[model samples]
Target: MALEQLSEVIQRCQALPENSYTSEDYDLFTVAGRTCIEEGNSLQLLSIVLDEKNQEIVQCMGWNLLPPLVQVLLKKENKDLPHCLAVFNHLIEVCRPKELLIGLLEQLEHDDPDTTAESLHVLLTPLQKLLNLGVRKASSLGMALSSVLEQLCKLPVPETTEQEQDDVFSLGQCCSELSAFIQPFVEEAQHNHIRGKDSAQMMGDLPHNEDELRTELLKCMQVLSRLLLGVQLRDMDTLPESPLRDFASSILIGDSLPALVHRPLLRHRHIPGFLEEEVRYPKESLACIAHLLFVHHLLADMFPTVYQELYEKTLVRVEDCGLPVDLLEIKSFLSVPQNLVKVMTICPHQNLRSKGLKVFQLSIDKFNTEAKYKFFLMLKTSNHSGVEGYIIKNIKNQIDSALKAEGGNVWFEGLHLLPLLRSVLMLPDGPETDLLQYMDIMESLNLLRYLVIRDKTGIWTELYKIEDTFLKPLRVGINMSRAHYERELLITKEDKKTKAKVSVGDEKLPNMTTDTHIKALHSALHTFDMIESVLVRIEELVD
Candidate 1:
């Protein structure tokens, strides 16, 4: 019934004049995609269309019909395994449901590694869309990726036969294609405006739903990140026989680092006809690549050596390019190290700290106004919630050590670290408390004290001297606390008296004197007094 409805919709759409069908066709296609899944029988029809034996039927279904049908099959629950698998195999051959194919590729990465690798190759034709989807789905997809990667890492190097080399080469081709596809999407995700609801919402307001486009793009990036990391690790062992050895070697040798770092301006000189067509580049590619590199550096053992070479190469390029190199590219390159610092702090390695510190130093130097602000914001947000404990702890330690070693002076002088500090103070209640304890107890106290002293005597003294200025707000807060405590005390005493009066005939009334209530009142008053005292001390210094 569902397939019949879909067929009716397709026929109706096909009957419309070509010029008139543009908008109507899209609506029909969307409905068909949705309905095919709603009615379980859609898969049976899709199977017929996708079957190799029914080439005419497959060709007649056309590209438009393929994507939605694939979507239906993919989304179907309690689906017949044989039918679904057959449909999937056909979809791979036709590359009709490009989006669904990308989704499956990502899903496959988490399945058995050998199976996933084969699946990845089969789905490689629509490499660009696949890469975009990988990036969009990276966060959710990261969990299952390591297993497939582990298998790829275990593949035998210097294969005994030509076929073995060819298989490895095929995998490399998939990786390269996948990498190119996702690179842009990752870049966009990074530059995604923090002020907006999200990249998807922003994209939605445009012609098509930007959210879906971005989501698909991110999924692609994630898949690419996993695939590239796996391929790089695998090829590292097969350097002699690997087709990707040169590309891998180039990355290792730092030859590609400059191009990658300055990728915004560099055209793909190697790709034929790239120069002739005016292809509008996607914004997220570089950002995505940087993230991929950062992740590889963080998770894979091979990245440190690769990153070191890349880092040195980047520094050289910056030096030669001078101060006015493309700010966006520079920001992207600088972010790699900071991300590594955050990643290493949680994961930990004795060797990583120095590398993290080096990157930190470089970030401090190269990070401009916008970059600095964004970094602090990320620290603040990461510190708040959705951040791991070890990472938070490591970051706190790094910040503290930097501050104690006068690293604070550098951070303060160059970029404001106060926002990052503010985030630390406001950390969400969780296991991350260990990280907070390190800073909240002593560091925050010291920082607050330092600010108080600086306001009194330093360049900020005049700001403190003004009436109803720096110290006034603290006084107001103290007064509010005192008033709130008084109100609570009154309520407690009234409750105690009411309870004493309501005692039963046989039950003697306990001492319901508001003593405990009074004690709490005293404690609250004491805290208010302490706050007042701190403010008074500041007022005196201003005088």
Candidate 2:
């Protein structure tokens, strides 16, 4: 086409309403995009028309075309590529195709430092949005990111000048964007690999460019650690677990993560003349390592079995190294609950109980009684509330003794012990009458009335009826306990199990159905009625 005719076409295309960029009209935008690149004009004008400042354009283009634009830009190679780069940058920030953007980032490995650096900045800008979009399809994006990281690893590390060494150590602000962009992918890849899946093979392809890949991976990991640490103040459960969880866990358990985290870089240290300052590189590295370990522990807590395995693994190491048992006791305690419960029920190992109790004691010392109480309360509120209650009361006596040395602040802590008590009361009656009586003792000591009163009025009324005479007594008891109960009750041997049992004459198990048995049948019928009523209420509520 003649230049004048092409200009006319371009202008005509631009003049069309944004809706013109439909799937059927995508070819027009593609041609325009290419033509602008050839003519060294900003394709950003077309992108802006198609992407930003025009929702209709985006709707018309459909979501899929966004990736094609990125694919075209990444595949095309042009030095002094101002228009293409500008358009590419604009497209990333505006109409991001998460997988495609990630794929484009892989090209950073092939680009020079200046281009790679610029691309890195563009890539990092929309990362949180990309992650939020949940693009975990294991696209070619993973391999591409791994490649770019490999290139960074190959960058020659400059010798630190004494003055530079004295400054606060940072992972270089320029690399920050690149680091952030690659962190999640790296984590995802690592997780896939650890799970014995080939989904992470993309990351493995960069070993040929080992130095660059390794350096970039470390930088990405550091950025992730910082990001996670900043947000750690929020509830840990809210954070998504990616491969980074395993990466951190491996280091904490003295696994392969330390080597990966401390991989050698090309940077060198330099000493300045007449300076008395010593650069604390190792210290900073150790601090980062500790932070990573903490993150790993937080992740492991979500999976009790995994936490137990990792903890036991750590204990074996501590024993082999002749390390002070007390030094690692806290981690062991944190990891041992799952194992301790198994031991208590399955094998009844004395050693396990002793060690578990010792660890619990240490936890009480390290954290105030309030912290331990809250921690146990949280456990009771988790999905395993039933099991946690069983374990806590079994060790309640020891816990009480530990708290008593601090002047009995356990009950006053008021850490919402209701969930635990409710779980106990709901335990199925069988050969477990002793367990029931034990629960009764804890309830009496801890004042179950607080829980009953604090409960939702609707639920409380539905659950139990108070005789007019009992109401005043119950309210008075609750208030008295709320004001004066400074220490939780200590469970003694008698509290652990009751002597109550069914005597043959009193109520033959195979024959007589006594008043107690008849009352249970009535309770079951009442419960069924309540459930049917609640379901009807739920249906009404939905309507």
Over 283-345, each residue of candidate 1 has an lDDT whose tens digit, in order, gives 444443554455334223433345533564466445321333245457676467557657446
What TM-score goes with each of the models? 0.33, 0.27
- Summing lDDT over every window of 10 consecutive residues in candidate 2, give the lowest-scoring window: 271-280
Q: Which regions of candidate 2 fall more than 4 Å away from where they truly are?
A: 1-28, 37-40, 43-90, 93-99, 111-114, 137-141, 162-171, 182-543
lDDT of 2 by residue, 407-515 (tens): 3544322334334334433423322223222233233323233334333212243234222222233334334443332222222222223323434678635423344
How high a TM-score does candidate 1 get? 0.33
Question: Which residue pairs clash in candidate 2?
Answer: 106-144, 150-212, 150-213, 153-212, 154-212
For residue 193, model 2's alpha carbon misses the true position, in angstroms, by: 17
